[model samples]
Target chain A: MGVKRFIAVLPQCQALGMRVESADHEHVLFSLPFAECHIGNSRKQLIHGGVIATLLDTACGSVAVCALPRFEMCPTLDLRIDHLRPAVAGKALYCRASIVQVTPRIVFTEGVVYQEKGRPVSRAVANFMRLGAGKTPVEMDEALFSPNNEGEE
Target chain B: MTYSDSMAQLVSETQRSGHWETLLEQIPYAGFIGLTAQTLGDEILFCMEPLESNTGNPLLPALHGGVIAGFMETAATLNLMVSLNVDQVPKVIDFTIDYLRSGKMKPTYATCILSRQGQRIANVQVNAWQKDRETPIATARVNFLMHDK
Candidate 1:
Protein backbone atom coordinates (compact mmCIF):
# COMPACT_ATOMS: atom_id res chain seq x y z
CA MET A 1 0.00 0.00 0.00
CA GLY A 2 1.13 3.58 -0.64
CA VAL A 3 2.20 5.73 2.28
CA LYS A 4 -1.05 7.68 2.23
CA ARG A 5 -3.08 4.53 1.80
CA PHE A 6 -1.44 2.76 4.70
CA ILE A 7 -2.01 5.73 6.94
CA ALA A 8 -5.69 5.71 6.13
CA VAL A 9 -6.01 2.04 7.03
CA LEU A 10 -4.36 2.17 10.48
CA PRO A 11 -4.30 5.69 11.77
CA GLN A 12 -3.78 4.79 15.44
CA CYS A 13 -0.76 2.57 14.87
CA GLN A 14 1.39 5.68 14.40
CA ALA A 15 3.07 5.60 17.83
CA LEU A 16 4.85 2.33 17.11
CA GLY A 17 7.66 3.83 15.05
CA MET A 18 7.16 1.10 12.48
CA ARG A 19 8.83 0.97 9.09
CA VAL A 20 8.05 -1.44 6.31
CA GLU A 21 11.29 -3.33 6.36
CA SER A 22 10.32 -5.37 3.32
CA ALA A 23 7.33 -7.08 1.65
CA ASP A 24 6.14 -9.38 -1.09
CA HIS A 25 2.75 -10.60 -2.22
CA GLU A 26 2.87 -13.66 0.08
CA HIS A 27 5.05 -12.26 2.85
CA VAL A 28 5.69 -9.00 4.75
CA LEU A 29 8.31 -8.00 7.30
CA PHE A 30 8.42 -5.09 9.77
CA SER A 31 10.87 -3.58 12.27
CA LEU A 32 10.95 -1.57 15.55
CA PRO A 33 14.14 -0.16 17.02
CA PHE A 34 14.63 0.28 20.73
CA ALA A 35 15.75 3.40 22.60
CA GLU A 36 15.70 4.94 26.09
CA CYS A 37 11.97 5.51 26.23
CA HIS A 38 11.09 1.83 25.84
CA ILE A 39 13.32 0.65 28.65
CA GLY A 40 11.90 -0.36 32.02
CA ASN A 41 15.16 -0.59 33.94
CA SER A 42 18.94 -0.83 33.70
CA ARG A 43 18.50 -4.50 34.49
CA LYS A 44 15.49 -4.79 32.20
CA GLN A 45 13.17 -2.91 29.82
CA LEU A 46 9.43 -2.36 30.05
CA ILE A 47 7.63 -3.22 26.81
CA HIS A 48 3.86 -3.36 26.85
CA GLY A 49 2.70 -6.90 26.30
CA GLY A 50 -0.22 -5.82 24.13
CA VAL A 51 2.20 -4.55 21.49
CA ILE A 52 3.34 -8.08 20.81
CA ALA A 53 -0.23 -9.31 20.65
CA THR A 54 -1.07 -6.74 17.99
CA LEU A 55 1.90 -7.75 15.85
CA LEU A 56 0.74 -11.34 15.81
CA ASP A 57 -2.85 -10.39 15.05
CA THR A 58 -1.87 -8.23 12.07
CA ALA A 59 0.59 -10.76 10.70
CA CYS A 60 -1.97 -13.53 10.87
CA GLY A 61 -4.69 -11.37 9.38
CA SER A 62 -2.45 -10.45 6.46
CA VAL A 63 -1.27 -13.99 5.93
CA ALA A 64 -4.90 -15.13 5.75
CA VAL A 65 -5.29 -12.96 2.68
CA CYS A 66 -2.25 -14.30 0.91
CA ALA A 67 -4.39 -16.19 -1.57
CA LEU A 68 -6.85 -13.38 -1.96
CA PRO A 69 -6.46 -10.29 -4.09
CA ARG A 70 -4.79 -7.16 -2.84
CA PHE A 71 -6.86 -4.71 -0.78
CA GLU A 72 -8.90 -7.58 0.54
CA MET A 73 -9.61 -7.76 4.28
CA CYS A 74 -9.18 -10.76 6.56
CA PRO A 75 -10.13 -10.57 10.21
CA THR A 76 -8.66 -12.61 13.01
CA LEU A 77 -10.73 -15.32 14.64
CA ASP A 78 -8.31 -16.72 17.21
CA LEU A 79 -4.96 -15.35 18.38
CA ARG A 80 -2.83 -16.92 21.10
CA ILE A 81 0.57 -15.72 22.24
CA ASP A 82 3.23 -17.35 24.46
CA HIS A 83 5.60 -14.66 25.63
CA LEU A 84 9.08 -15.96 26.44
CA ARG A 85 11.14 -13.15 27.93
CA PRO A 86 11.37 -9.46 28.76
CA ALA A 87 12.68 -7.42 25.84
CA VAL A 88 15.85 -5.46 26.42
CA ALA A 89 15.44 -1.84 25.52
CA GLY A 90 17.73 0.03 23.11
CA LYS A 91 17.93 -2.76 20.55
CA ALA A 92 16.64 -3.45 17.06
CA LEU A 93 13.91 -6.04 16.50
CA TYR A 94 12.82 -7.92 13.39
CA CYS A 95 9.41 -9.49 12.74
CA ARG A 96 8.68 -11.81 9.81
CA ALA A 97 5.64 -13.88 8.86
CA SER A 98 4.06 -16.05 6.12
CA ILE A 99 0.91 -17.95 5.42
CA VAL A 100 1.28 -21.55 6.54
CA GLN A 101 -2.14 -22.87 5.63
CA VAL A 102 -5.20 -21.33 4.07
CA THR A 103 -8.67 -22.65 3.45
CA PRO A 104 -11.75 -21.24 1.88
CA ARG A 105 -13.17 -20.34 5.26
CA ILE A 106 -10.07 -19.72 7.31
CA VAL A 107 -6.37 -18.88 7.09
CA PHE A 108 -3.81 -20.43 9.36
CA THR A 109 -0.47 -18.76 9.85
CA GLU A 110 2.75 -18.85 11.87
CA GLY A 111 4.91 -15.82 12.57
CA VAL A 112 8.07 -14.99 14.50
CA VAL A 113 9.64 -11.95 16.22
CA TYR A 114 13.38 -11.78 16.64
CA GLN A 115 16.29 -9.65 17.77
CA GLU A 116 19.17 -8.57 15.58
CA LYS A 117 21.77 -11.30 14.90
CA GLY A 118 18.83 -13.61 14.25
CA ARG A 119 17.94 -14.57 17.81
CA PRO A 120 14.54 -16.10 18.30
CA VAL A 121 12.28 -14.09 20.62
CA SER A 122 8.70 -15.21 20.24
CA ARG A 123 6.61 -17.38 17.90
CA ALA A 124 2.88 -17.22 17.29
CA VAL A 125 0.17 -19.10 15.41
CA ALA A 126 -3.20 -17.72 14.53
CA ASN A 127 -6.31 -18.27 12.41
CA PHE A 128 -8.22 -15.71 10.39
CA MET A 129 -11.61 -15.91 8.78
CA ARG A 130 -11.97 -14.62 5.29
CA LEU A 131 -14.61 -11.95 4.85
CA GLY A 132 -16.87 -11.68 1.87
CA ALA A 133 -15.80 -9.37 -0.86
CA GLY A 134 -16.65 -5.74 -0.03
CA LYS A 135 -17.43 -6.77 3.55
CA THR A 136 -15.63 -5.26 6.48
CA PRO A 137 -14.25 -7.73 8.98
CA VAL A 138 -14.83 -7.52 12.70
CA GLU A 139 -13.17 -4.62 14.44
CA MET A 140 -10.40 -6.03 16.59
CA ASP A 141 -8.41 -3.23 18.12
CA GLU A 142 -5.45 -3.12 20.54
CA ALA A 143 -7.59 -2.60 23.60
CA LEU A 144 -9.07 -6.01 22.94
CA PHE A 145 -5.70 -7.73 23.24
CA SER A 146 -3.99 -6.01 26.14
CA PRO A 147 -1.78 -8.32 28.21
CA ASN A 148 -2.89 -6.57 31.36
CA ASN A 149 -6.03 -8.67 31.26
CA GLU A 150 -6.95 -12.00 29.74
CA GLY A 151 -8.48 -10.78 26.48
CA GLU A 152 -11.89 -11.92 25.30
CA GLU A 153 -12.80 -12.48 21.65
CA MET B 1 23.65 -6.51 16.43
CA THR B 2 27.11 -6.64 17.97
CA TYR B 3 27.44 -5.76 21.62
CA SER B 4 29.71 -2.92 22.63
CA ASP B 5 31.31 -5.10 25.26
CA SER B 6 31.44 -8.81 26.07
CA MET B 7 29.35 -8.09 29.15
CA ALA B 8 26.91 -5.18 29.19
CA GLN B 9 28.43 -2.13 30.84
CA LEU B 10 26.10 -0.15 33.11
CA VAL B 11 26.88 3.43 32.26
CA SER B 12 25.14 6.78 31.99
CA GLU B 13 24.86 6.42 28.21
CA THR B 14 22.72 3.36 28.84
CA GLN B 15 20.29 5.29 31.07
CA ARG B 16 20.17 8.22 28.65
CA SER B 17 19.04 5.82 25.94
CA GLY B 18 15.53 5.78 27.46
CA HIS B 19 13.41 5.09 30.51
CA TRP B 20 13.01 1.43 29.61
CA GLU B 21 15.79 0.54 31.98
CA THR B 22 14.26 2.65 34.69
CA LEU B 23 10.95 0.84 34.43
CA LEU B 24 12.51 -2.58 34.15
CA GLU B 25 14.03 -2.16 37.58
CA GLN B 26 10.58 -1.85 39.11
CA ILE B 27 9.40 -5.22 37.86
CA PRO B 28 10.46 -8.49 39.48
CA TYR B 29 10.55 -10.94 36.61
CA ALA B 30 13.51 -13.23 36.09
CA GLY B 31 13.26 -13.56 32.28
CA PHE B 32 14.26 -9.98 31.52
CA ILE B 33 17.26 -9.45 29.20
CA GLY B 34 18.16 -6.06 30.70
CA LEU B 35 19.56 -4.57 27.47
CA THR B 36 20.27 -0.87 27.22
CA ALA B 37 20.15 0.72 23.74
CA GLN B 38 21.54 -0.12 20.36
CA THR B 39 22.11 1.67 17.03
CA LEU B 40 22.11 0.66 13.38
CA GLY B 41 22.12 2.36 10.03
CA ASP B 42 18.73 4.04 10.41
CA GLU B 43 17.76 1.30 12.86
CA ILE B 44 18.42 0.35 16.48
CA LEU B 45 18.36 -3.06 18.22
CA PHE B 46 17.10 -4.01 21.71
CA CYS B 47 18.56 -6.84 23.78
CA MET B 48 17.40 -8.89 26.81
CA GLU B 49 18.61 -12.13 28.35
CA PRO B 50 16.44 -14.06 30.77
CA LEU B 51 17.57 -14.39 34.32
CA GLU B 52 18.02 -17.86 35.77
CA SER B 53 15.48 -17.33 38.50
CA ASN B 54 12.60 -16.38 36.17
CA THR B 55 10.57 -19.55 36.51
CA GLY B 56 7.42 -18.04 37.93
CA ASN B 57 5.17 -19.58 35.34
CA PRO B 58 5.31 -23.23 36.25
CA LEU B 59 3.09 -24.08 33.31
CA LEU B 60 5.36 -22.39 30.72
CA PRO B 61 8.59 -23.13 32.60
CA ALA B 62 10.11 -19.80 31.58
CA LEU B 63 8.64 -16.29 31.42
CA HIS B 64 4.98 -15.41 31.96
CA GLY B 65 2.58 -13.92 29.42
CA GLY B 66 2.76 -10.48 31.00
CA VAL B 67 6.56 -10.52 30.82
CA ILE B 68 6.62 -11.77 27.26
CA ALA B 69 4.33 -9.00 26.10
CA GLY B 70 6.70 -6.53 27.66
CA PHE B 71 9.59 -7.91 25.60
CA MET B 72 7.59 -7.84 22.38
CA GLU B 73 6.87 -4.17 22.95
CA THR B 74 10.55 -3.47 23.36
CA ALA B 75 11.33 -5.13 20.06
CA ALA B 76 8.68 -3.05 18.33
CA THR B 77 10.26 0.10 19.68
CA LEU B 78 13.55 -0.79 18.03
CA ASN B 79 11.86 -0.15 14.71
CA LEU B 80 11.20 3.41 15.82
CA MET B 81 14.86 4.16 15.28
CA VAL B 82 13.97 3.85 11.58
CA SER B 83 10.58 5.55 11.40
CA LEU B 84 11.20 8.42 13.77
CA ASN B 85 14.88 8.62 12.85
CA VAL B 86 15.55 9.39 16.48
CA ASP B 87 16.35 7.51 19.72
CA GLN B 88 13.01 8.24 21.32
CA VAL B 89 10.54 5.63 22.54
CA PRO B 90 7.54 4.96 20.33
CA LYS B 91 4.12 4.90 21.98
CA VAL B 92 2.17 1.75 21.29
CA ILE B 93 -1.25 2.35 19.86
CA ASP B 94 -2.34 -1.29 19.83
CA PHE B 95 -1.15 -4.82 19.06
CA THR B 96 -1.99 -8.56 19.08
CA ILE B 97 -0.02 -11.76 19.60
CA ASP B 98 -0.43 -15.50 18.95
CA TYR B 99 1.36 -17.85 21.24
CA LEU B 100 2.34 -20.81 19.11
CA ARG B 101 3.83 -22.88 21.93
CA SER B 102 5.08 -22.52 25.43
CA GLY B 103 8.63 -21.26 25.57
CA LYS B 104 11.44 -23.55 26.60
CA MET B 105 12.70 -23.51 30.17
CA LYS B 106 15.38 -21.14 28.86
CA PRO B 107 15.79 -17.67 27.43
CA THR B 108 13.62 -16.33 24.59
CA TYR B 109 14.88 -13.81 22.06
CA ALA B 110 12.88 -11.33 19.98
CA THR B 111 13.26 -8.90 17.04
CA CYS B 112 10.88 -6.65 15.13
CA ILE B 113 10.46 -5.46 11.55
CA LEU B 114 8.79 -2.27 10.38
CA SER B 115 6.27 -3.13 7.70
CA ARG B 116 4.82 0.37 7.26
CA GLN B 117 6.27 3.69 8.31
CA GLY B 118 4.39 6.95 7.86
CA GLN B 119 4.39 10.55 8.94
CA ARG B 120 1.93 9.89 11.78
CA ILE B 121 1.74 6.13 12.32
CA ALA B 122 3.81 2.93 12.26
CA ASN B 123 3.24 -0.85 11.97
CA VAL B 124 5.63 -3.45 13.34
CA GLN B 125 5.90 -7.23 13.64
CA VAL B 126 7.87 -9.14 16.27
CA ASN B 127 9.09 -12.79 16.43
CA ALA B 128 10.39 -14.62 19.48
CA TRP B 129 12.04 -17.98 19.96
CA GLN B 130 14.26 -19.88 22.28
CA LYS B 131 17.52 -21.84 21.63
CA ASP B 132 16.57 -22.42 17.95
CA ARG B 133 14.73 -20.37 15.38
CA GLU B 134 13.15 -23.44 13.82
CA THR B 135 10.57 -23.37 16.60
CA PRO B 136 9.10 -20.06 17.69
CA ILE B 137 7.15 -19.59 20.90
CA ALA B 138 5.26 -16.41 20.06
CA THR B 139 4.76 -13.69 17.44
CA ALA B 140 3.15 -10.24 17.45
CA ARG B 141 2.02 -7.22 15.35
CA VAL B 142 2.05 -3.74 16.82
CA ASN B 143 0.86 -0.22 15.90
CA PHE B 144 2.32 2.92 17.40
CA LEU B 145 1.74 6.68 17.32
CA MET B 146 4.50 9.09 16.28
CA HIS B 147 4.33 12.42 17.99
CA ASP B 148 6.76 15.19 18.88
CA LYS B 149 9.95 14.19 20.69
Candidate 2:
Protein backbone atom coordinates (compact mmCIF):
# COMPACT_ATOMS: atom_id res chain seq x y z
CA MET A 1 0.00 0.00 0.00
CA GLY A 2 1.03 3.61 -0.56
CA VAL A 3 1.99 5.84 2.36
CA LYS A 4 -1.23 7.85 2.17
CA ARG A 5 -3.40 4.78 1.93
CA PHE A 6 -1.57 3.07 4.77
CA ILE A 7 -2.22 6.03 7.02
CA ALA A 8 -5.81 6.41 5.87
CA VAL A 9 -6.59 2.77 6.60
CA LEU A 10 -5.20 2.95 10.15
CA PRO A 11 -8.17 2.70 12.50
CA GLN A 12 -6.59 4.92 15.14
CA CYS A 13 -5.75 7.59 12.57
CA GLN A 14 -9.29 7.45 11.28
CA ALA A 15 -10.69 7.79 14.75
CA LEU A 16 -8.49 10.81 15.44
CA GLY A 17 -9.28 12.39 12.06
CA MET A 18 -5.62 12.63 11.07
CA ARG A 19 -5.06 13.98 7.55
CA VAL A 20 -1.99 13.60 5.42
CA GLU A 21 -0.90 17.00 4.23
CA SER A 22 2.09 15.81 2.21
CA ALA A 23 4.37 12.77 2.09
CA ASP A 24 7.48 11.65 0.30
CA HIS A 25 10.60 9.60 0.91
CA GLU A 26 12.36 12.51 2.65
CA HIS A 27 9.58 13.61 4.98
CA VAL A 28 5.87 13.39 5.78
CA LEU A 29 3.53 16.02 7.15
CA PHE A 30 0.19 15.45 8.83
CA SER A 31 -2.55 17.60 10.34
CA LEU A 32 -5.14 16.88 13.02
CA PRO A 33 -8.15 19.15 13.41
CA PHE A 34 -9.31 20.28 16.78
CA ALA A 35 -11.96 18.18 18.49
CA GLU A 36 -13.60 18.35 21.88
CA CYS A 37 -12.56 14.80 22.59
CA HIS A 38 -8.90 15.78 22.25
CA ILE A 39 -9.07 18.25 25.10
CA GLY A 40 -7.31 17.14 28.30
CA ASN A 41 -8.18 20.16 30.34
CA SER A 42 -11.83 20.92 29.84
CA ARG A 43 -11.68 24.15 31.83
CA LYS A 44 -8.81 25.56 29.79
CA GLN A 45 -9.61 23.60 26.63
CA LEU A 46 -5.93 22.75 26.22
CA ILE A 47 -5.05 19.89 23.93
CA HIS A 48 -3.88 16.81 25.79
CA GLY A 49 -0.17 16.20 25.94
CA GLY A 50 -1.00 12.65 24.92
CA VAL A 51 -2.67 13.97 21.79
CA ILE A 52 0.55 15.76 20.89
CA ALA A 53 2.46 12.52 21.42
CA THR A 54 0.00 10.66 19.18
CA LEU A 55 0.46 13.16 16.36
CA LEU A 56 4.23 12.98 16.64
CA ASP A 57 4.26 9.20 16.74
CA THR A 58 2.06 8.98 13.66
CA ALA A 59 4.13 11.48 11.71
CA CYS A 60 7.40 9.88 12.63
CA GLY A 61 6.14 6.38 11.90
CA SER A 62 4.72 7.45 8.53
CA VAL A 63 8.02 9.03 7.50
CA ALA A 64 9.76 5.83 8.43
CA VAL A 65 7.37 3.95 6.18
CA CYS A 66 8.29 6.27 3.32
CA ALA A 67 12.02 5.76 3.82
CA LEU A 68 11.77 2.06 3.29
CA PRO A 69 12.24 0.55 -0.17
CA ARG A 70 9.02 -1.36 0.17
CA PHE A 71 6.27 -0.85 2.72
CA GLU A 72 7.35 -2.76 5.84
CA MET A 73 5.86 -3.01 9.27
CA CYS A 74 8.26 -1.00 11.44
CA PRO A 75 7.21 -1.04 15.06
CA THR A 76 8.38 1.80 17.27
CA LEU A 77 11.23 0.80 19.57
CA ASP A 78 11.48 4.02 21.51
CA LEU A 79 10.24 7.61 21.37
CA ARG A 80 11.19 10.86 23.05
CA ILE A 81 9.05 14.00 22.96
CA ASP A 82 9.60 17.51 24.31
CA HIS A 83 6.54 19.63 24.81
CA LEU A 84 7.81 23.12 24.06
CA ARG A 85 4.50 24.61 24.98
CA PRO A 86 0.89 23.65 25.46
CA ALA A 87 -0.96 23.60 22.15
CA VAL A 88 -3.48 26.39 21.74
CA ALA A 89 -7.09 25.43 22.08
CA GLY A 90 -9.34 24.81 19.05
CA LYS A 91 -6.54 25.02 16.51
CA ALA A 92 -5.54 22.32 14.09
CA LEU A 93 -2.16 20.76 14.88
CA TYR A 94 0.45 20.01 12.22
CA CYS A 95 3.49 17.75 12.41
CA ARG A 96 6.39 17.28 10.02
CA ALA A 97 8.64 14.28 10.48
CA SER A 98 11.73 13.13 8.65
CA ILE A 99 14.30 10.40 8.88
CA VAL A 100 17.31 11.29 10.99
CA GLN A 101 19.07 8.07 10.23
CA VAL A 102 18.34 4.55 9.04
CA THR A 103 20.30 1.42 9.71
CA PRO A 104 19.89 -2.18 8.67
CA ARG A 105 17.97 -2.79 11.89
CA ILE A 106 16.39 0.51 12.93
CA VAL A 107 15.06 3.79 11.55
CA PHE A 108 15.53 6.98 13.54
CA THR A 109 13.11 9.87 12.98
CA GLU A 110 12.68 13.39 14.32
CA GLY A 111 9.61 15.59 14.07
CA VAL A 112 8.17 18.90 15.19
CA VAL A 113 4.58 19.82 15.94
CA TYR A 114 3.07 23.23 15.40
CA GLN A 115 -0.20 24.99 14.96
CA GLU A 116 1.22 27.77 12.83
CA LYS A 117 4.12 27.80 10.41
CA GLY A 118 6.98 28.86 12.68
CA ARG A 119 5.78 28.49 16.21
CA PRO A 120 6.45 24.91 17.27
CA VAL A 121 4.60 23.46 20.21
CA SER A 122 6.54 20.20 20.61
CA ARG A 123 9.37 18.06 19.22
CA ALA A 124 9.93 14.33 19.08
CA VAL A 125 12.60 11.79 18.24
CA ALA A 126 11.80 8.14 17.76
CA ASN A 127 13.33 4.91 16.47
CA PHE A 128 11.48 2.01 14.93
CA MET A 129 12.59 -1.58 14.51
CA ARG A 130 12.64 -2.62 10.86
CA LEU A 131 10.52 -5.69 10.42
CA GLY A 132 10.83 -6.58 6.73
CA ALA A 133 7.94 -7.16 4.35
CA GLY A 134 8.22 -10.84 5.16
CA LYS A 135 6.77 -9.97 8.55
CA THR A 136 3.76 -8.29 6.96
CA PRO A 137 0.65 -10.31 7.60
CA VAL A 138 -1.04 -11.58 4.46
CA GLU A 139 -4.48 -10.58 5.66
CA MET A 140 -3.35 -7.02 6.44
CA ASP A 141 -1.67 -6.68 3.05
CA GLU A 142 -4.79 -7.75 1.20
CA ALA A 143 -7.09 -5.70 3.41
CA LEU A 144 -5.00 -2.54 3.02
CA PHE A 145 -3.62 -2.60 -0.53
CA SER A 146 -5.66 -5.04 -2.50
CA PRO A 147 -6.42 -3.45 -5.88
CA ASN A 148 -9.66 -5.37 -6.24
CA ASN A 149 -10.83 -4.40 -2.74
CA GLU A 150 -14.13 -2.55 -2.73
CA GLY A 151 -14.24 1.23 -2.20
CA GLU A 152 -10.99 1.90 -3.93
CA GLU A 153 -10.88 5.65 -3.60
CA MET B 1 -14.87 29.19 43.36
CA THR B 2 -11.93 29.65 41.08
CA TYR B 3 -11.02 26.87 38.65
CA SER B 4 -7.83 26.01 40.48
CA ASP B 5 -9.60 26.05 43.81
CA SER B 6 -12.29 23.74 42.52
CA MET B 7 -9.67 21.48 41.00
CA ALA B 8 -7.80 21.34 44.28
CA GLN B 9 -11.02 20.47 46.06
CA LEU B 10 -11.77 17.77 43.59
CA VAL B 11 -8.33 16.27 43.97
CA SER B 12 -8.63 16.25 47.73
CA GLU B 13 -12.04 14.64 47.55
CA THR B 14 -10.76 12.04 45.16
CA GLN B 15 -7.84 11.22 47.35
CA ARG B 16 -9.94 11.08 50.45
CA SER B 17 -12.63 8.95 48.90
CA GLY B 18 -10.20 6.78 46.91
CA HIS B 19 -12.39 7.30 43.85
CA TRP B 20 -10.07 8.08 40.94
CA GLU B 21 -12.78 7.41 38.39
CA THR B 22 -14.33 10.80 39.22
CA LEU B 23 -11.02 12.44 38.45
CA LEU B 24 -10.67 10.58 35.16
CA GLU B 25 -14.02 11.93 34.09
CA GLN B 26 -12.61 15.45 34.05
CA ILE B 27 -10.19 14.52 31.29
CA PRO B 28 -12.21 14.28 28.09
CA TYR B 29 -9.45 12.67 26.12
CA ALA B 30 -9.07 9.93 28.72
CA GLY B 31 -12.70 9.03 28.40
CA PHE B 32 -12.56 9.25 24.62
CA ILE B 33 -9.88 6.57 24.60
CA GLY B 34 -11.67 4.36 27.13
CA LEU B 35 -9.18 4.85 30.01
CA THR B 36 -10.14 3.83 33.50
CA ALA B 37 -8.33 3.74 36.84
CA GLN B 38 -8.50 1.36 39.76
CA THR B 39 -6.91 2.06 43.09
CA LEU B 40 -5.01 -0.70 44.89
CA GLY B 41 -4.01 0.50 48.31
CA ASP B 42 -2.06 3.72 47.63
CA GLU B 43 -1.18 2.70 44.11
CA ILE B 44 -3.34 3.12 41.03
CA LEU B 45 -3.53 0.80 38.07
CA PHE B 46 -4.68 2.35 34.81
CA CYS B 47 -6.46 0.26 32.21
CA MET B 48 -7.51 0.81 28.63
CA GLU B 49 -10.26 -1.59 27.56
CA PRO B 50 -9.77 -3.17 24.17
CA LEU B 51 -11.44 -0.97 21.57
CA GLU B 52 -11.46 -1.61 17.84
CA SER B 53 -10.87 2.06 17.08
CA ASN B 54 -7.55 1.91 18.94
CA THR B 55 -6.18 -0.75 16.66
CA GLY B 56 -3.25 0.09 14.41
CA ASN B 57 -2.39 -3.32 12.94
CA PRO B 58 -5.53 -5.37 12.43
CA LEU B 59 -3.60 -8.50 11.52
CA LEU B 60 -1.80 -8.56 14.86
CA PRO B 61 -4.86 -6.90 16.27
CA ALA B 62 -2.48 -4.66 18.16
CA LEU B 63 -3.09 -1.35 19.84
CA HIS B 64 -1.76 1.69 18.03
CA GLY B 65 1.68 2.84 19.16
CA GLY B 66 0.26 6.31 19.67
CA VAL B 67 -2.61 5.01 21.75
CA ILE B 68 -0.18 3.15 23.98
CA ALA B 69 1.87 6.30 24.46
CA GLY B 70 -1.22 8.39 25.13
CA PHE B 71 -2.46 5.94 27.71
CA MET B 72 0.87 5.92 29.54
CA GLU B 73 1.13 9.70 29.45
CA THR B 74 -2.37 10.08 30.83
CA ALA B 75 -1.58 7.56 33.53
CA ALA B 76 1.52 9.48 34.54
CA THR B 77 -0.32 12.79 34.60
CA LEU B 78 -3.08 11.50 36.82
CA ASN B 79 -0.65 9.73 39.11
CA LEU B 80 1.30 12.95 39.56
CA MET B 81 -1.84 14.96 40.25
CA VAL B 82 -2.99 12.54 42.90
CA SER B 83 0.45 12.00 44.40
CA LEU B 84 1.25 15.67 44.78
CA ASN B 85 -2.30 16.68 45.54
CA VAL B 86 -1.98 19.60 43.21
CA ASP B 87 -4.62 22.14 42.24
CA GLN B 88 -3.71 22.53 38.56
CA VAL B 89 -3.14 20.00 35.83
CA PRO B 90 0.49 19.08 35.41
CA LYS B 91 2.06 20.13 32.11
CA VAL B 92 4.28 17.65 30.34
CA ILE B 93 7.79 18.98 29.82
CA ASP B 94 9.13 15.93 28.06
CA PHE B 95 8.29 12.27 27.63
CA THR B 96 10.39 9.24 26.64
CA ILE B 97 8.96 5.83 25.90
CA ASP B 98 10.50 2.45 25.06
CA TYR B 99 8.34 -0.20 23.45
CA LEU B 100 9.45 -3.61 24.53
CA ARG B 101 6.67 -5.47 22.71
CA SER B 102 3.67 -4.83 20.56
CA GLY B 103 0.60 -3.86 22.57
CA LYS B 104 -1.93 -6.51 21.71
CA MET B 105 -5.66 -6.00 21.42
CA LYS B 106 -6.38 -6.69 25.06
CA PRO B 107 -7.15 -4.76 28.17
CA THR B 108 -3.80 -3.04 28.68
CA TYR B 109 -2.75 -2.00 32.17
CA ALA B 110 -0.23 0.54 33.39
CA THR B 111 1.31 1.58 36.69
CA CYS B 112 3.19 4.79 37.41
CA ILE B 113 6.05 5.37 39.79
CA LEU B 114 6.71 8.95 40.87
CA SER B 115 10.46 8.98 40.58
CA ARG B 116 10.95 12.46 41.95
CA GLN B 117 8.75 15.41 42.88
CA GLY B 118 10.43 18.73 43.19
CA GLN B 119 8.61 21.94 43.96
CA ARG B 120 7.97 22.84 40.33
CA ILE B 121 8.69 19.65 38.45
CA ALA B 122 7.99 15.97 38.88
CA ASN B 123 9.35 12.90 37.13
CA VAL B 124 7.26 9.80 36.58
CA GLN B 125 8.03 6.42 35.07
CA VAL B 126 5.24 4.30 33.61
CA ASN B 127 5.15 0.63 32.63
CA ALA B 128 2.35 -0.85 30.57
CA TRP B 129 1.59 -4.53 30.11
CA GLN B 130 -1.04 -6.89 28.93
CA LYS B 131 -1.73 -10.47 30.14
CA ASP B 132 1.26 -10.47 32.45
CA ARG B 133 2.85 -7.76 34.58
CA GLU B 134 6.21 -9.55 34.53
CA THR B 135 6.65 -8.62 30.89
CA PRO B 136 5.96 -5.03 30.00
CA ILE B 137 4.94 -4.08 26.48
CA ALA B 138 6.12 -0.46 26.91
CA THR B 139 7.79 1.77 29.46
CA ALA B 140 7.97 5.55 29.62
CA ARG B 141 9.48 8.39 31.61
CA VAL B 142 7.56 11.65 31.80
CA ASN B 143 8.64 14.98 33.23
CA PHE B 144 5.86 17.35 34.22
CA LEU B 145 5.86 20.99 35.21
CA MET B 146 3.60 21.47 38.15
CA HIS B 147 1.78 24.72 37.55
CA ASP B 148 1.52 27.08 40.48
CA LYS B 149 -1.86 27.90 41.90
**Winning candidate number (DockQ):** 2
- Estimate TM-scores for all models: 0.44, 0.95
lDDT of 1 by residue, B1-149 (tens): 22222112322244345434433343322123343435544344455555433332332244434345556766676445434444444556655766666555565777678889887788888887776666767777877776653
lDDT at B146 for candidate 2? 79
Q: Write the per-residue lDDT of candidate 2 for residues B1-149, one digit (tens) a residue.
A: 99989999999888788887778878888988899987788898899988898888776778898899999999999888887789998889999999999888889999999999887889999999997889999999999887765
Q: What is candidate 2's lDDT per residue for A46-73, written digit by digit as tens?
A: 9988788888888999899788876678
Measured by TM-score, the strongest candidate is 2
* Native interface contacts retained, candidate 2: 0.85
- After superposing candidate 1 on the true structure, give the runs of residues whose Cα lies further than 4 Å from its correct spot: A1-4, A35-43, A137-153, B1-149
* TM-score, prediction 2: 0.95
* Highest lDDT model number: 2
**Model 1 local distance difference test score:** 0.53
For every candidate, give the share of true A-B contacts it also has. Answer: 0.15, 0.85
